[model samples]
Target: MRTSRVDTTIFGATSLLTLALGGVAPEQITVPAPVASEDAEAVAGLWLSADKTVRLRLDADWSYLGRVAGRHRAAKGTYRPEGTGLVLRDDTGLRTPVTIADDVLEMAGHHLFRA
Candidate 1:
């Protein structure tokens, strides 16, 4: 008799596997900074592509929706306004951190001029 087996994981799904293996509880998720609602509103507006690389224009009216990577993408989520900072998220459940000051949105330390 012979038997062989190997464990495998799909790409982009490792996060889930890691959580399951480590038995990390949902409440244990660590958020670097607590987002505030007020800060989200401050960044709601039409943002143009400055570098023309990412090709993202943010439209935050009632909720956060924007295009990213030169593609027309919509993200349904909330943001916590932090003074001059904004944190965005979407239905896909991804958190995007950005800071807005004087009409400039600083996404990942890169500032995008207001359109």
Candidate 2:
């Protein structure tokens, strides 16, 4: 008989994980980490492309979706903080670096303003 590995993780203000094989006692894993600070949480919001042609919605869940004006959705991706900026990994597997300061966001050759 082959045993399978099971991993379960719970994240938020608290992070806990359980892992083990079927019918076996699960081992607990504790990782020390901050849930999500308000400053980092600030990234969750809407942003507009400099050309005023695109609007991107960033959710707290790391979902990054964008839409073009009067057209269909454009780019979709996930983002995580990298250094002082953020890196956007699109559906195409492209990693785009983004920098934000104040109310301005610079990414993918376009300047985005908070919307």
Candidate 3:
């Protein structure tokens, strides 16, 4: 009688690499983490909803946009500070009101947080 054994070594190597990338590679990367200078806290980074169903991001270029559950485009617009609130203006020229309190962002009766 003859018996054969199939190789499983490749999967093992892939699994090890995946874990190492998660646990070790991120630290070894040369990219610098963002620092919150007083000016930086003014704008930037990922934002999301209280229900975790929506997400948004702001860049220094004055560009702002939002997604639904990190998948579909829900809102995209330009944003700027107006007093303590933010004004989100869509391409259609429609404007929405956004307020930031502590770490929570309130807009259209939905609450969001910095993520």
Candidate 4:
């Protein structure tokens, strides 16, 4: 069965509780490692939203900068590979998940394409 992130969190908590209560713990609780995407490098470049209102620039150093309407800052963050996507941690402590498929990138309901 495929487990969601919430499910994994619950399972981990349950395992910890069981151990704390002097119950036998399961054989092991494994956390999946982050997968390195071959597309990581390809993802580093300028991107724009469908309406051309939002612009996102991803750098090879894992840093990103986003703008709206070509001049207004929208987001600035650092990203890392997570599963088949990426986790972008912004300067304001907000984390956004980004999914890549073919030549498109999706994040927070916005679809972006290479510029």
Candidate whose lDDT is highest: 4
Off by over 4 Å in 3: 1-41, 69-73
Q: How do the residues 22-92 of candidate 1 rate in per-residue lDDT, one tens digit apiece?
A: 96655665534434554434455666557654433444453655656655655566655654466677787
Query: What TM-score does prediction 2 earn?
Result: 0.58
Model 4 worst lDDT window (10 residues): 26-35
TM-score of structure candidate 3: 0.57
Q: What is the lDDT of residue 73 in candidate 4?
A: 51
Sort every candidate by TM-score, greatest first: 4, 2, 3, 1
- lDDT for each of the candidates? 0.60, 0.71, 0.70, 0.80
Positional deviation of residue 21's Cα in model 4 after best superposition, in angstroms: 40
Q: Residue pairs in steric clash, candidate 4?
A: none
Model 1 bad stretches (over 4 Å): 1-42, 53-62, 70-73
In order of lDDT, best first, we have 4, 2, 3, 1
- What TM-score, computed on C-alpha atoms, does each candidate reach? 0.48, 0.58, 0.57, 0.62
Where model 4 places Cα greater than 4 Å from the true spot, the runs are: 1-39, 70-72
lDDT of 3 by residue, 23-110 (tens): 5644354532332333334657888887788777877766788777646546777877766677788777879877767767788878
Best by TM-score: 4
lDDT of 4 by residue, 1-115 (tens): 9876654445477677777867855444343344485556867999899898878888988899888775655789898888867888889989989887777889888999999
